[model samples]
Target: MAARDPGASVPVRAAVARQAVEWLVELQSGEAGDATRAAVQQWRAAHPEHERAWQHIAAVNARWRGAAVPSPLAHAVLLDTPAVPARPLPRRAAAKTVAALLCAGGGAWLAHQATPWREWRADARTGTGQRRTIVLADGSQVSLNSGSAVDVRFSAGERRLRLVSGDILVSTARDRAARPFIVATAEGELRPLGTRFAVRQHAGSSRVDVFEGAVAIRPRDAGQAPPRVLQAGQQARFSAAAVADTRPADGDSVAWADGMLVASGMRLADFLAELGRHRHGRLGCDAAVADLRVSGSYPLADTGRILDTLRATLPVEIHFITRYWVSVRPARR
Candidate 1:
């Protein structure tokens, strides 16, 4: 290793930067296992820039530590090591860092919460508060949700999409070339059976809701286990190991495509969390009012109005701490 110049930062591709951030997120999640740590080591060794990006964070965090920053929040965020903090930063913290990286010299697009850093490098993407419908070379339609991304790869033999992050509703178009339409995610693979369906990805799992036809789901690590087939109106959530039992698909799953957030007695915290995905920065709920139930078909385009409606109906106050940070709490007496 050579002593790097302080003035010249290494040019890091968005792809490599994303991998670094992903490792950081898992490390900060406080739930990383031994396998995860080993995987992180292998990833760092896989490329020189991988190590550079990683050391960049570690060095920055080290500088923060040496500065003796007294704030607990600062320490929690700056401690990027395997040593877990008393209160680890949420996954959103990693998301925020990746968002910044996307904006840093890459001409990449920053995404909303719940999106993986890899989305920055995706072939097609939708940003915070944005949705798009993409027609594939095979004529298939992919309707991206807020903060979604996908990469398309088509050849004479196959038509495939790699889901980088977030969620999408796919409407398959018959291919003149007789190519199979497949979608790959970090957790597994999906082969649609002439269908319309929605796919959503999170940290360790993937979910699919089938609307018109059937879909076959094979977990990434389920080497010998049979892939589950989901029929119309069915849904399932699966991880690398196995698939959960299929259930009737919730009609509201696709409501976002219609610019609606349909909540049926959802917790106030959960509702705001979903709504937060459409907005930038932090949206939190104090524990005192977190479990309050909410039901509505609110227009997603008007989250501000939705908050006003909540303020009117529920016994809660909307605190606008800043333009970027909002919280729901028990109304002061």
Candidate 2:
């Protein structure tokens, strides 16, 4: 072959690199079996560049599995591949360059592993005093407060999360055709009809609060009863029975995400209960002080400062049983 035009080979390499990346994704999902392997083999047999690309991907996989290959060396392998030819080569001889071609595509595959979508999602849990917000590929926003766990799944037909523990605030964005978003817990499945809501899972039950638009609640199995539609500002609890007995969500109820705990004339005990969920330890109030009125918005991010503020305002004493345990008792008159 006459001298190949260097620029003519660019698109060929680019196309091969793209195809290799897709293959890498498929392989990571555990779906590339015999037939897929055969297809890859055929591609490799057709071109040396294809074989190079596959080899690069294999090297990256080996590194991810704790092989001794370093990232710098892997990158070098990809960058060192020969330039593409101006004309397509004879198919059989192309296998010579497969390893070099794979190197060109492996970088992206390695980076994908660092992303949440590529990682094995679900079984994700947060420890006390920890919060995480994740953006799903489908454009959904999920904000998990302290001590929470939820499994996320998105398919072409549905977006779902099974809340195994703790709380999650989901703001579902409008899909191309406005698909429904559903969050399921032990209590039931809360389907947001293209709206934003928060699901809080407790020991024996779970709560759903709709902040925007409408949502529907149904049992997990969907055999017992029909789903109930909940409008904005409506809240419900799923326990022994689906209870619509809900109060208005004040500023305090939704302020914790912003580090504020808004308590609007709530009981001392109830306020403490709410605060305890956002902290790393336990908080309690003595029986005598349990009924004391709590009417201020405290900082959820800094529980210690909030407790100090409470001490200065209320006629109570803060007791520290341990770093993780605390209680309050009414001050003597």
Candidate 3:
């Protein structure tokens, strides 16, 4: 059985649990061949927690062996329906219903866990409060910011870096092979024309900031628009359908590569949100102080000290719910 850690985040636990449930479902479906079974054994052995989650899920399945539960009831539970039964279900029947609920809920959870699983399998990643630089085989350097993941693929024709999640600062090195360098996000692909630049992946869009030379932003959908070129000191955001207008880039866009967050008149809420990206757990600002402005070059390595500085200089107070959870509110007069 996998040893459970009390400190693991909900997302991490859910991801593991989902993987376990997926393995169980595949094996039980009677289609998993000998190789599939062997792979499952290897996976379970790879992590004790995987075995533990599987055992627990198996126990849940065992409870429904002899009882029948309505599919609608199971589906309702998976959807988090608020409707309640007028009369309580019988004990044996209730156990069967609960087991069905667990199976359906697990399937839904797996769908939500897909992205995190990809990040887990990323070729390169950085943890919270940590930054990493990987020198590619071609001598180009890619720096990953905290909580970032990227997959590097260098083929004979082109050098591609997939921004799986988070942000990266790329310094292009002249390739002796003369392969074109490109960075891809869900929204589009960025082709650097001998440039130093940064690419950040947001929820539904990707941002490109060019520090030197130029980059061509091409939307993933070919008919959306033509590729737009951004020169040095320019930044732009693009979605699958369209590219936004170019704006003047700022030092803060690439400052994380230097282990600092350079904010000039940034909103308190925005600052805290960016800081939270580098720190573990949750850090938020109350609406009362969210609009306040902040400016400075704060070290990303010391989030606590940065928060302390904010409290000292601004009209805001920091509240610690736990070491992992914090909020900033209007300072008490």
**In candidate 3, residue 15 scores what lDDT?**
41
TM-score of each: 0.69, 0.60, 0.69
Q: Which 10 consecutive positions of candidate 1 have the poorest summed lDDT?
A: 105-114
- Model 1 lDDT per residue over 1-333, tens place: 432322125566544555566566666566765556666666666668777766655544444444433233333335433545576556665556534533442221222222445575578987677888988877789999987899999988989999988899999999987889999988999999899999998778999999999999999999988889999999999999999988899879689999999999999989987898787545779999999999989998878999999999999999975554578999989
Task: Write model 2 residue lDDT over 83-109, tens digit each, in one string.
Answer: 233343332222223333334334444
| lDDT string, candidate 3, 1-333, tens digits | 533322222233554554554444334433445554555666566667666555544443444434454433332222322324444344334433444545443543334445544565588987667898999998899999987889999999999999988899999999998999989999989999999999999878999989999999999995756699999999999999888989998767778999999888999999888898887545778998888999889988789999999989999899875565578999998
> What is the lDDT of every predicted structure here?
0.75, 0.62, 0.72
Give the better candidate number (1 or 2) by lDDT. Answer: 1
- Residue 88 C-alpha lDDT in model 2: 36
**Highest-lDDT candidate:** 1
